[model samples]
Target: MANFNDSNVLSSTFYLTGIPGYEAAHCWISIPFCLLYLIGIVGNSTILHIIRTDSSLHEPMYYFLAMLSLTDMGMSLSTLPTVLRIFWFDANEMTFDACVTQMFFIHSLSLMESAVLLAMAFDRYVAICNPLRYATILTSRRIIHIGLVLLCRSTVLLPPLLIHLLWYPFCDSHKLSHSFCLQQDMIRLACADTTFNRMYGLALVIFLWGVDSLGIIMSYIFILRAMLSIASREERLKALNTCASHICAVLILYVPMIGLSMIHRFAKHSPPLVHILMANIYLLVPPVLNPIIYSVKTKQIRRRILQLLAPQRCFSTFK
Candidate 1:
């Protein structure tokens, strides 16, 4: 409740917490967190490498999967350093500028992931509903354009908001509940009336993530309609099966996202561990699991990964 527009406040730094009230367990917690980071980085990187080398995977769906993998890699890399620092080394201090940068990357990557998932859903719809024209619809040039648009859309919207944040006066404790910086967490510490910040945050969520989710749901509706028209049940299942990995990816991303949002909004009274756990799940689960899901559900990716692991066993057929 003190005045924070003074010079001292301008230079103030925040200290991030690692599972509040569990300092003794921070080291223990770091093990699983580090493992998740390793899986996410290696798994997504392997996906990109396989996609790049496998000419057979040079299609729209795989192209979108590659984009998703790239986004997953970005998300993991963006958060890994701060997360490990907090849990492993107890280095929780973050300067304001650095915090803003981290927040921008985390939020921007999340929006980009939402856009990529929507794009993937559209790819599935085109592949299933109109296979004959799928190639024409999502050509390589068009896919590149879509990726650029998604990236640009996220890249452009956040800088102005972040700039606004950099100037806000902080009147509250500079301690954040999680290992990573987040716009919502940081803004709540501002002494200034953050009506605009709160509203813009809500609008951004609704316009970007909300619309992307709606687009995905609509695409699935059309896909379902197209599948139902097929007379053969097995054929319908096969067509739908193609989207299984994507469906799982969407669930993994959005389910935790929704849970995190709800926890921030309505569960302030709940135990700090609940919020910390949800935040970790949101930051860690998607990147770690997305590649695994795709490799398991998609036959081509699975076979290619297997071939990569055991080349001699597959050389007879793959070669």
Candidate 2:
């Protein structure tokens, strides 16, 4: 760690030898990941544009969808370049402030995305269960308000949480097991007793993510009940179908969080390369796959994506 008295500084200059073995294998994996990231960026950007330009899609559903895309971009911005550096250039060292910034953004966006998913679930429930009030409840003003609340909530919560992390003292072992300085990885480096850190983290997880997930499940329960009550079997089936993509998305994020936490606890001493691989996968999997799942599940979005990618007809009846 850096020797500064006041600022808790890890050293600025650091060494990062390339991946231990199978360097070529890492490169092969990274090449495909880079392509996936490119697709994610382009695809999400197109969705944002279509959502903005098409007045029909300006409701709360696509609004939350756009926010989800934005949060994914933020998550990618925080994780991907550092991961690429680790994979391609062997440039893994990060300054103390850089590492803290990375951690804060990654966590902040993650929390915000969770809140956005919550909003989406509420939207779905209302649409399926109470179509009449959906327009009034999910109006433009209400969505804007919800967006602000989500942004402010994550911003306020994450900074104080980060300050606590930053000031917690670290031991001399500056080497983080993961490709990026995740919360637990950085805490492992702490010189002070980190029981407090673990407890606080668990509390946050239970309160924020855990409770929100429960709420999503409840929303789905109510939605299913309402779907069953509908007179038309086709309407009931359609309502059920609309929820499939969100269920997949929720699984992608929360299931990985479980794997990541487990790996941090039981497998920290595992191979350094495996640690790095899981870290990158945890960050990349949800964002890269989310827009794809939603697009495939939602026909309107799929059509828009296809039309945007289609080559324009050159000489079709110019008159």
* lDDT per residue (tens digit) for residues 181-242 in model 1: 99888888887788878888899899999899999999999999999899999998899899
Q: What lDDT does the true structure give each of the candidates?
A: 0.89, 0.78
Worst 10 residues of 1 by lDDT: 1-10
- Name the regions of candidate 1 deviating beyond 4 angstroms: 1-11, 317-319
Could you tell me every candidate's TM-score relative to the true structure?
0.96, 0.89
Where is the poorest 10-residue window by lDDT in model 2? 310-319
Q: What is the C-alpha RMSD of each candidate to the true structure, in Å?
A: 1.8, 3.3
Candidate 2 C-alpha lDDT tens digits along 53-121: 888888888999999999987888777777789878778788777887888888888888888889889
